[model samples]
Target: MKRISLFLLLSLLLGATVLYSQNPETNLRVVSVSPNAASLGTFGMIPTSNYVGQASLSIPVYEIDLDGKKFPITLSYHTDGTRVAQEATWVGLGWTLQAGGCVISVFGSNAKIYSANYYDIKGRVVKTVRSNLLGGYDITSTTYTF
Candidate 1:
């Protein structure tokens, strides 16, 4: 009986190891957002646009895979009545994975501003940065924490 139990345990352990080895250690998530209200603004300017009123805006949400590269692959989805924008003038454009975290970007068409969110390994947002058309104004590099 003891020998039979040991053999069964070893077989189970080996089978589990084989199953685990077949999958890669990677986590991929797609994020989307849209603005609830927006205002007119200029390029290279800080976002200070006032919301005219509460209204539904049709915006595109994209799923992007950066793979730690400079450029990203973004897939867009058009849907109505999804109000999930970070700011009044910000619309989500794309996303990427960098430095053991996820970075989600938003674009302000009138303002020509780009904003990004940095998320940790646990998928919690650690920091956010906003920049202008020239990739300036408030963009900064940060280190990811576990």
Candidate 2:
């Protein structure tokens, strides 16, 4: 009886651990800059995007720069597409800034997105690590990225 109880407890603990780690509310932010130092080149503008995933759902938001204005985009979840959200809701009004690169946000964590990236101005991946997240739990992450 003692051995059986111990085995059952270990099995339950392992299952719980697997579920928590497998389906975590992970968020990823990407930032890249141009090699040129003159101006915001055609593809030099460092766009911002995020993927808030909880359980099996996801909510992705991307901001594309045009001329001197920033466009707000909110794409919904999709299962067929490779990049998740295909249909989106465009709201041309939102807060955006381009200090060193085009800034974009989804929740309220600007520093999280900015600091999560490991790439520098040369577009090369550097060291990357973070202690904790800068946003809340997203319960609507229908789609996710690997």
TM-score of each: 0.18, 0.19
Candidate 1: pairs in clash: 34-85
| Model 1 spans with C-alpha error above 4 angstroms | 1-19, 24-29, 35-42, 45-146
Best-performing candidate as measured by lDDT: 2
How good is model 1 by TM-score? 0.18
* lDDT by residue for model 2 (29-138), tens: 43333222112221233332345321222244667788989765542222222234222223211222223344322232233333343533333444443322332322
Cα lDDT computed for each candidate against the true fold: 0.34, 0.35
**Per-candidate clash tally:** 1, 5
Q: Model 1 residue 21 lDDT? A: 33
Highest TM-score: give the candidate number. 2
Model 2 scores worst on lDDT over the 10 consecutive residues at 137-146
Error of 1 at 91 (Å): 15
